[model samples]
Target: MKYGSTSAPIQLARGQAMSSVKPWRPDEPAATIHAEGAWLQGAFISKIFYGIIIVLSWQCLSLLWRQTTRSNYKTKMSFLAIVFAIFSFSTLHSGYDMKAIQLGFVENRNFPGGPSAYATLSRSDTPGNIACILMQWLCDALLIWRFVMIYRGCVAPMWLLAATPITVYLGSIVIGILFTIKKLTSGSGVRRT
Candidate 1:
């Protein structure tokens, strides 16, 4: 054989290399879990994770305002009180504990199957699921109190008075319930598809 000539072995090796380095094929089918139509599993937690910091910052500012303004102490304190209460609840509900639950580091005993069984199959866990559920319930109660106060304080538009707090409380309740149910039924194990 002529040493410099193109030969079958070189051609076969080149063919093998090309096949081994084949590009990804878009036509390949993909599989994913429906996850019971839950939206909060991924997107929701990420949003809330970032939002906790902002809520805590607001709480800090409200506290500082109350401390610095002596002449308007009553007004500042009142505003700060409301802000602090809300922020405290928000922080507790949105804090890292919730994230840990979501991430599945802390097992959710509330799940239907035994913790080990569920854990064996789950992919992700939201850490603060418990805190969020409790917080939403608390928010509902607070909204009722606020609604009553607003009604007694002034003759505001009926629509505005009815809509704002009701929407917030109800929305939170719905979200919390949905997340709780999802967590309970989804099993205890973590698996990635």
Candidate 2:
């Protein structure tokens, strides 16, 4: 027989027969969790991780901004702008993800139905993804700019100034690439019934 085919029947003894089924227990919860709940729980954990990263990045930027009295006004303003952009993007992404999770988890059904469900359920179409991409690029640029400013203003060695930007860019690139890969490969997995 072919796989998944159920055409074959079992022979039973003359006295054997199926018994009536019992109702599910009231005290026992459903054995399987909904896909929406699972997705939202994952998103919540991710949001928390990203939130901590944002906080640490902001603190580092703040320290750099405070030490900017020794640098030029233009550089200071540029740094401030970069910091503001990062903060805005982080906040926006976090808020949007939270909303998406809330809608998916609380509603238990995609909004409106049909095509609308795709729009409601997918994070790729959300503003958060775009913001996240932009923020990642901005972070790389800011790191490079900070390194340049430090090198020019304080006569610091190129290697010393390169450290932060190199590390930040690598980290951002890794994160962006991983997220993209996850989005792409997730579709190939077996879907829940």
Model 2's alpha-carbon lDDT is: 0.63
- Model 1 Cα lDDT, one tens digit per residue, 65-139: 847666887866765665565556556655554444444423454444333334445634444456556655765
lDDT of 1 at 130: 63
Cα lDDT of candidate 1 equals 0.57
Most accurate candidate by lDDT: 2
Q: Please tell me which predicted candidate would have the highest TM-score against the true structure.
A: 2
Candidate 2 residue pairs that clash: none
**lDDT of all predictions:** 0.57, 0.63
Error of 1 at 20 (Å): 16
